[model samples]
Target: MNGMLPWAISFALIAVALAMIFAAIRLLRGPAAEDRVLALDTLYVNGMILVLTLGIQFGSRFYFDIALLIALFGFVGSAAMAKFLLRGEVIEP
Candidate 1:
């Protein structure tokens, strides 16, 4: 069971990495700012998931902290981008 776990995680990590790469391509080639932002958000999410999968595969807790930080920053950045798109500015002042 233990040996199987690492293999499963490795597969999942590879899948997520592929998805993130696709998302990055979309972000770069997107025709609109909104599309780029959405792709970037997707990339961030996939990256966090990949981090968690790595943590599981290696039996380490270190990646979890990095994942949490990535998620936090991703959320904040997405929110700011959305606000700017909707109102033309991220902050009123």
Candidate 2:
């Protein structure tokens, strides 16, 4: 029973890693600005999930903090990019 959890986490980690790779490729190769932005968002989410699972697998609270930071930064970056795309700028005067 104890062995299955680790195996599951390992599999999930690998899956998330693969997702991140694909998202990176999309970000680099996407032809449109919106596509690139979407890819960037996906990449950040996959990374955050990966870190969270790693934290669980390793039983450490430090990774949790890292995951939280990732979430915060990723959301802000994505929002800024979207705003720039929509309004030609990220900040308003």
Clashes of each: 0, 0
- Tens digits of lDDT, candidate 2, 1-93: 569999999999999999999999999999999999999999998999999999999999999999899999999999999999999999999
Scored by lDDT, model 1 comes in at 0.93
Off by over 4 Å in 2: none
Q: How many pairs of residues in model 1 come into backbone collision?
A: 0
Residue pairs in steric clash, candidate 2? none
Q: Which lDDT tens digits does candidate 1 get at residues 1-93?
A: 458877788799889999999999999999999999999899999999998998887889999999999999999999899899999999999
The local lDDT score (0 to 100) that residue 82 gets in candidate 1 is 86
Q: Residue 48, candidate 1: how far off, in angstroms? A: 0.3
**Candidate 2 vs. true structure, TM-score:** 0.95
- State every prediction's TM-score relative to the real structure: 0.91, 0.95
